[model samples]
Target: MNCRTSLSSWQALTTSSERLKKQHLKTLFDSDSGRFDKFSRHIPGVLFDFSKQLIDDSTFEQLVSLAKESDLAAWRDKMFAGEKINFTEDRAVLHVALRNRANTPILVDGTNVTEQVQSELEKMKGFSERVRSGEWQGYTGKSVKDVVAIGVGGSNLGPQMVTEALSAYADNTLNVHYVSNVDGVQLAQVLKKVEAETTLFVISSKTFTTSETMNNARSSVNWFLESAQDKSAIAKHFVAVSTNLEKTREFGIADENVFTMWDWVGGRFSLWSAIGLPIALYLGYDKFVEVLEGAFEVDEHFKTAEFEQNVPLIMALLSVWNTSFLGHTSQAILPYDQALHMLPAYLQQGEMESNGKHVTFDGQTVPYTTVPIIWGMTGINGQHAFYQCLHQGNVIVPADFIASVEPQVALGKHHDVLLSNFLAQTEAMMAGVNEEQVRNDLQSKGKSEEEINELVAHKIHKGNRPTTSIVLDKVDAKAVGRLIAMYEHKIFCQGIILSVCSFDQWGVELGKGLANNIEAELTEENVAYEHDSSTAGLIAYYKQKRNK
Candidate 1:
């Protein structure tokens, strides 16, 4: 396969990127009165405005052409059709099947994955209902009141983010706590809040052998065993989401208590599968279904919508235009809603883990950058913290400003204040205050000419920073579902356009493998592994200090 850089559309985008770099975003808006109308798309719950981005109509069309040239449509179809697009893993990418609410029969390896997904979802619904309704009691014959969800990376982030985002809607029947860190502090802190008898542990690991998750699980079991004194009690308090039933069974969970996930579903995208059991258990199963329904809506739209009007496609195009073409190295995900405080962290893992590869599908090194460093916090906090660097920093960082029209909890003037800042930040970033404007404002405030001249340069903001604004109708379960699904498709489209394998995360595996090797050396004296001077010296120093 030819590199994407060799494509005709890629050359056109390269030229456009050079021309657009000299052009200000304010100039683009000034040249067109209908810029917002032309550059925005409206979905069911989202209004995506990219007019503030540094792109013209011709450039946008060329981006759409780039998508076509890369055969993005064909690739998308193969994914929806359950073909093995995850070539590295030799597995079909079928997280979409998990949320196929239409009940479509998606076949993979001669078996209907849609049927399998539906079966697993049924299990989650039934189990969640049993626990929430107080029918699934503890071994001590007491109703469960607390849930400790133990998993790391994708298993932990997706469900924890969803539960935290929608905690406002929870009825307080159960308190959900997530333990992902292997440091033991996070698990210990959560253990302080609930007793072993009334707390349910949902261990989510596809292989049931992820070092961090398994370590936390074992410690949790040890804590529980101290109270119960019988291994059989583990069956009542501990359930699992894993394909490794033998391992789960050996760990004392019953076979019926184990929910299965297929190899086809990548961990980062497994939230919609039985991995979302904690979500269903936290906020009744119906609400969890709403999340799936929302994502399914975006999936259908992603399939049928034209390349020009499709939001996720547009998102991918913008990312490529900014990163690979314009040479931006980082992007910020700034969510204005407090409910979405974890949004940035969740997307950091989602995009980075998926597309943070240097090589293309054929093992050739990609000529252009693949993925940006994804980072940010809630918008309000970021405004006070990093908006300074954003407004006047030497490096340009494109940001996605996300907000909702309705607040989850309606308080007088709070949402209004939040929306005002969200709107102003994007505008200020795009059309920055010039030296003249700053001088005039200072003059009006009764500052002398000396003061005005001295402060004007420092106050001047060269307003051409690119930002995309996303406004949701509300941040409910359905809207959260739509928001995440849109980004999920965006990641998929980005991988196809960049010619990188998005489904495989070998970089993460390399780190995990190294950590596994080093873990034993930490405990065994004189069992040293060869390393670079930096690593070897650090380990030797730690060992010497401990022996002292």
Candidate 2:
């Protein structure tokens, strides 16, 4: 039987969860003075403190056993070797190859992806340099001053998040805009701000046929032609990052301007590839390379680190321990830095979309839960919003609190206050205020017994909420890169342990295929098709509103 069915570690964790229910974190901390040191790890430029997580030494050892029994190391080796681990899609999960900074040869189907990645990097560097140096001209013989990147999902989110997250590192030489929405309002607003004379459009789509991306690209072309008034001028103003070279060339993007995206790299994880052109354009190619180098360093560590000391593996195991064994259904990712505001959302898609599966590799329905509903906002804001539920609610939501030790922008005492809140919140979650402590404070304040009795229930907080605090040395391009790669590896480990395919997202496609048919009907008032009762009623209501 598989580990899911008959693993000794699984039984151990199940029993441990039951036993720990009666124990408070305060008691556990009292038992070990060195819990923090024992539970945390300091990597190159980041420190991960999992001390707040509800795990003792025995639980940690069992998680390690889980990894060992699951053959995690062997599976990881298979992924790094570029084997077709994405069995449903028959594709190699090689996003690691995109940022192989050491120029190490990674073979996929006996072909070196590293060399191709280097070639693309060199091309991107050359092209970005030419544009930056005013060598690349727009349709009207002007240097490119603005860039509008058009793509959705991985193409938009990853690159946009990185660029926005690392805005301080940008040169401000170019104004970069992104339009991922299918709605015309976003595209129109972006186009209205930039003149066609000096603007460049980067139409990124792996297939060069994504519905939203192609629509936006076509609209952008029409918008540009309003000024240039020539179809031939399209080549100078537009470029593409797509594998469908034939489609891109037919669309008038020059051969040189059409970059590549391999099938081995999924869109959500393609920021290290040419999909990160906006990042390179705004922050310069060198900084972009720094991001790649940061991720590469983590790749090396993840590849070689032992299970006992491994960061990503430990994180994955903790997630499994919390979600599967402890019955927590959702995880919160609260990043403390303002620069990392997008971190939670980016990770939402990265984790949920990757590992949110209901079936095993052989299509057997899973008896246990897989990925959690990942949700959170900036740490301070979340304290005001959903942190209440995380603290006192019935659901046990394990969270990862990410913050930087050094402020990216040193503004007076702001960083200190942020850091204080960061440290305090995690501590508060772990060691909640008891009624005894609340009553002691109330009595010291000279509150009468009647007033104290009324307030006690509201003031009492049951602690032992689990958390992981990640402290980055600082929020730089490299640190952000390392941070993202760490989570990617964690998701990989998570899927492997859950007996699910992490790389395939057939669930996402089901909606898209349905929407395609629905779109055709929406365009024709008289046309209709078979539909569910709720869907049919909804469509009728929409058409009635439209006709009116």
Candidate 3:
């Protein structure tokens, strides 16, 4: 693979900061009456309205051309066909196959991976049914009443986010808990809630050797054994989603209890794979299937839909327009529903970890930015937090406003208030308060001329901030699945547009490797290791204080 370093026209447009500064989203909308029809896309129960963004038809056309120049279609096909598109690891990026509802045959090596996916899904269904129906019992002959999922990164975030999003749909037969943080506080908190005898642990690690995951797994095992009273009982209570059967056996999980994860699946995209065991355990197997089916629907749309009509492609192009053409440095994922509170964090890892690269596929430095710093909280909470900056900040920040028409928890007028805020924020962002409006409002309040001038300056909002509103009919298992897959595909498209590999994450490895060495040093009290000046000083200070 040769390094590609040429800037796309979209990149060229954004290179001129002065040009971007002069363009306003409000002007873009005002100048075009069909802007909403041109920019918005709908598929199934989801509506993505990007008309409030700063881009016009010509800009969008240029983005489509950029996608063509990047050969996005070819890359998309390569991924679906199970080709070795993940160049860094020499693996096929085939998480799409995890939800292959068409049951299409996909091959990795000579093996039909679709068959393996189906088999694993069947295993998950059977296990989920037994556990949810009280047919699966622990060594103590008690039906499992709680689940503790132990994984890090993609393993943890995807399932945890989905389970939380679909919490209203949960049968409540068993309580589902997730432990991802390496901090002992996370594990200790979970241990205090569930009885170890009736708790089942789902350990998810592709290699079964992720340092944080394994450390947490070890702590969880110890916590379980404290109640079970026998190390042998670990086999009955602990299950694994990993291909490393040897490591799982060594860790005391029975062979039958060990599920499989494939190299074709990337961690962030593995929720559709066996990593979704926690989701199924929480919402029953049928709803879990609904999630997969929903994702498959998006998969079909992404694979078959044209560039102009494609929801994911439009989203990807709009992001490029915002970050590369409009000079926006960060993108916000603002979900109105409380159940989807983790979405921003989940997408932060999904988008940033995937496409936050400086280099293209062939090791050449990219001429433009790849991924924006994606961050946000739930919508109502954000209004009280950093929304002031979003409304009147010096820089333009593109935001995605997600809300459901129907609330999951209909607490009287709470949902209406939430929805009103959601609708009003986007409207305010698009149509900011002009100096005249501010002055008039001040005058109407009987302010003096000088006082009105002072207040107007602070009240005048440059309301051309770009935002996309994603309104879902509801947030069920299927809706959550479609929503997540929409972003996943959008991330993929953004990577393709930026000429970077979306599937590989070598960036996360450096810290994990260093942490292992640091952990060894801490445990052994080996203070002789060379380190950065800041780190050395900290370790020295800690060791001296401990010795005192």
Best by lDDT: 1
Ranking by TM-score: 1, 2, 3
Off by more than 4 A, model 1: none
Tens digits of per-residue lDDT for model 3 on 1-548? 32323546645545443464677767777778888888888999899898887766666776787788778899999999999998889999998999999999998898999999999999999999999999998989999999999999899999999998888888789899999999999999998999988999999998899988999999998878888899899988999999999999999999999889888788988999989999999999999999999999999999999988899988988887777655678999999999999999999999999998888777888777778999999988899999999998887789999999998988889989999999999999999989899888989989999999777788899898889999999988789889989999999998887778888877788888887777777668544667999998987788678778
Q: Model 3 off-target regions past 4 Å?
A: 1-20, 525-528
Which is better, 1 or 2, measured by lDDT? Answer: 1
- Candidate 2 structure quality by residue, lDDT tens digits, 1-548: 34375688888888998998778887889899999999999789999999888889998999999999899999999999999999999999999999987787889888998999999999999999999889999767899999999999999999998988899877779989999999999999999899998999999999998888999999999999999999999999999999998999899988889999899998889999999999999889999999998898889999999999899999999999888888889999999999989888888999999989988877888888898999888999999999898888877789999999888789999999999999998898899999999999999999999999999999888989999999999999999899999999999999999889999888889988888788889886567789999999998899889889
Error of 2 at 124 (Å): 0.7
Structural similarity to truth (TM-score) of each candidate:
0.99, 0.98, 0.96
In model 2, the Cα lDDT at residue 105 comes to 85
**Which prediction has more favorable TM-score, 1 or 2?**
1
Q: Look at candidate 1 and tell me the lDDT of residue 276.
A: 93
The candidates, ranked best first by lDDT, are 1, 2, 3
